[model samples]
Target chain A: MMWLFLVTDALLFAGFLGGYAFCRLASDKPWPDRTQVFDLTFITLMTFALITSSTTMASAVLAARNGRLQAARGFLLVTALIGLGFLGMQAVEWSHFIHAGARMDSNPWGVPGFSSYFFLITGFHGTHVLIGVVVLLLTTLRSLQRSNADELVEVVGLYWHFVDLVWVFVFGCYYLV
Target chain B: MSSQSGVSSYRTYWIGWLVLLILTVGMVFSGAKPVLVGGMLAKASIITLLYMHLMHERRRLVWTILLGIFLTSAVLVVLSVPDGMAM
Candidate 1:
């Protein structure tokens, strides 16, 4: 069930990225140099936070399956905190981008498509991260109250990892590629 | 399956994380388009297989998801981008 949901959601992103590619390629102007526009160090930190949280999420699922409820709770809490931090980092990145004159319709980079797609895609991914954090927190609270099925943790872990997976593409396409 | 312990499971996830980290960093430093896209795909595969536990799923499910997204995206790009490029 979750797998089906994730597959559909991934197709949604693929569509967005496809549109982005079309806009980028269709534009005659040169695209902004990614390195000049983005602070790679900060972006790397955001990626680290997300990837670490994913690891912690996987650990939580394993601990739950192993019948270590306390460990599961601990890991879930850690994962949620890291996810929250990643959101904050993303906010900072967005703020910086805006301050540098990037907007939905225009940017200092000359090619309007660059900033438009950057915000559109990353904004969509950030919303997913926000929802994942909220879900992680709820799962953590639920774990504290009762012994839930390990599958619950695994299901939530899948959602969290899927969010991370999307960011892997966003980061690659926007920041690196 | 039963023989694999919790510590080992944790180690596997961390190793996956480590590889993802390396690929991200490598892509950041390397300006080559092929390397960037290659690393991106590798990272995506690792996240899907290891982090998302797609590796344990049935083969049909795996192919469905992978091919569904790949083909759709490929069609989207291949059909649209050449016209854009020609403009």
Candidate 2:
């Protein structure tokens, strides 16, 4: 069921990205150069944070499988913290962009589509990360109780990895090429 | 799927994480270069296959996931071509 949800969610993102590509190519106005408007260093740090959270999530799953409940709880807590850190950075980035006059309807960069797509796509992905963090928190609590959380850890790990996977595409399309 | 014991070891996950980190740095340095897309694809595949344990899953399940991705990509590409051509 999670796989099915992921597959359909991926298709939804594909459609949004495809529409973004169309707008970018069809627009007469020059698209805003990503590097010019966004902080690459900050975004890179966010990427690392997210990937590290995935690592921590994997550790949590492994520890659970090994019946190390305390270790699993620790790892899950770390994962949640890292995810929260990533979202915090995103909030900062969004605020900076907004202060620079970028919005869904208008942008100082002259290409409205760029800001529109940027906010829409990144905002969508960020929301997923936020939800993942909340879910991780709950999973961590369950781990602390020493419940039979091995299966629960695996399911949550799948969702966490999916969030990270989506960010890979988001970073590629929005920040890189 | 096999039991939890069949899951890849922690070392495998660490290696995958390291590779993904390297790819993220590579993409940052590459800027908006076309090669960044390849790096992103590689990173995504590593996380899906190793970290997500899809590689150890049953072959039929793996194939289904791959097919879903492929079909989505094909549909999106086909849909985008006309708009791209119109540009």
* Best DockQ among the predictions, by candidate number: 2
**TM-score for each prediction?**
0.94, 0.95
lDDT of 2 by residue, A80-128 (tens): 9999999999999999999999889998988888989989999999999
Residue-wise lDDT of candidate 1 within A1-177, one digit each (tens)? 888888889888988888888887888898788778888999999999998999999899888888888899899999999998998998999999999998999888789889888888998998998899898888888644655557778888889999999988888877876
Error of 1 at A92 (Å): 0.7
Flag regions of model 1 displaced more than 4 Å: A143-147, B1-8
- Model 2 interface CAPRI class: medium
Predicted structure with the largest TM-score when compared to the true one:
2
Error of 1 at A171 (Å): 0.8
Where is the poorest 10-residue window by lDDT in model 1 chain A?
A142-151
Model 2 has an lDDT value of 0.86
On the 0 to 100 scale, the lDDT of residue B33 in model 2 is 65
Candidate 1 chain B least-lDDT 10 residues: B1-10
